[model samples]
Target: MTAVRIEREIERKYDAAADFALPDLTGLPGALGEPEVQRLDATYFDTTDLRLAARGITLRRRTGGTDAGWHLKFPVGRGVKEEIRLPLGRAAKTVPKELAGLVRAYTRGRALRPIARIETTRTLRRLLDAQGNPLAEIADDAVTGQALDRTEPVAWHELEVELTAGEPGLLDLLDERVRAAGASPAGSGSKLLRLLDHR
Candidate 1:
């Protein structure tokens, strides 16, 4: 079975150290709640020359957390993208044809192969409004990335804040809190891009 998700996916990434943590967000429209931990493992695929990535499209098969599945994402605008999901079928590590078709125009008949794999241990927190309605999710992650072409693995820490239900201004408010916590914006385009570039 398959499911489609159309979210604005407005998010920002910041580099972190091992002992990184979040600052007080209670001052914003939504207050930060307790943290919940989830593990995410995603194997990214693309043609040898990375045609999909060249166009800001990313395809990955991931396991862990509530949204574990095959996710195909393409950029729609700044900080926004479209994601399509399909079940991790019975096949062993294979890309679904349906998803492949969607990106066929960009792929131009090239083969999709696993190029990089990233594993992240994430701590998540929900941002809630005055009435306890959820507004956003803030995630702090420790990451390990390995490129199939390279033998060494790269390790890093980062933070990501994703909006669930809230006005766009909430994102900017939360952004201020993160920046004040001694964290800086990410130096790469995406997790997969970071891995491929290092290798």
Candidate 2:
């Protein structure tokens, strides 16, 4: 019953990477300005043995500001992931079946559960084009994460700039400005993976 697209034609890969950096476009209207750092607590889920990982997929239930819900982020391309959101529910410890079934191609009927918990303190800025269209979003994040098997905390800071629907060249233009702002690129390709790694 889910209207989600199958997209079987999409190719899958095991090892892919990209450089991520904070976007700098504070001068434009609708740009996100220095966001007060906020602590974000989230839990990531996957099949008992990571069936989703084998297929390059990620499913997580997160609670935070305006966007709290079940988020399923599918790998689309380098530096890009398509995020699907569902309404937040009462079940904080389990992945919603509605969202999980969408990953059947990857999970193959395997069970999914909590694999990690991630905590992030995010500082955000918004970038916009001259026409007031959102060109990109830049975020500076301080992350601390706890994996299921480990007790020690992992900490790091990263810059992330997500592009809006526009010319691809805009990313390059933004990247130039971001690098000039003294921010270096981070390793992961997707925000979901970065959060999951820490969780």
Candidate 3:
């Protein structure tokens, strides 16, 4: 096994929440509002009992369009989380060993398995500036979740805003527009948390 220099840290949850709205790149002149589109798929993961409730770490194998792989995301800040994706391998049921060590602080050697599954249908909008460079990506998502332990299916709708690699002010600008659109921020850190909660 390759030993990667892993950065370990803990994230605290807060009460702040809002709705996200940005722009859709696929729809340029038309924007995301012109024609509504949706991308649907399910995410699977494993977690310890208490960890699922508190920390919300999800280890799952995902198959979809461009981003089909194993994803682990740690909560970072408000409306932001650090996401890491590994290529999918034969070990679909077990968490990748490389990633398992990364979550060692939370798992403490406990075994992990699929505890929840989440299905999401996302409507995307791409935001850009006058220069035509991508400013941010806005996704309006309808989510359905299944918790394996409790056999409960929950559903909700929320907005997501992902920033481009440029000035921080751009995100602030988009944030204003999103809030103006009457969308409130949804908590749970990242998509990974939503997946864990479903399980």
Best by TM-score: 1
> TM-score: which is higher, 2 or 3?
2
The parts of candidate 3 lying over 4 Å away from their true place are 1-40, 129-133, 191-199
Model 2: which residue pairs collide? Answer: 31-126, 32-126, 116-199, 117-199
Can you write out model 3's per-residue Cα lDDT over 82-162, one digit (the tens) per residue? Answer: 666787777768888778777878877677777667677766655556666655556667777776766567777776656
CA lDDT of each prediction against the hidden true structure: 0.84, 0.62, 0.58
Candidate 1's TM-score reads 0.93
Model 2 residue 2 lDDT? 34
For candidate 3, the TM-score is 0.72
- Backbone clashes in model 1, listed as residue pairs: none
Q: Give candidate 1 misplaced runs (Cα > 4 Å).
A: 130-132
Query: TM-scores of the models, in the given order?
Result: 0.93, 0.75, 0.72
Name the weakest run of 10 consecutive residues (lDDT summed) in model 2: 8-17
Sort by TM-score, best first: 1, 2, 3
**Best by the lDDT measure:** 1
Q: lDDT of candidate 1?
A: 0.84
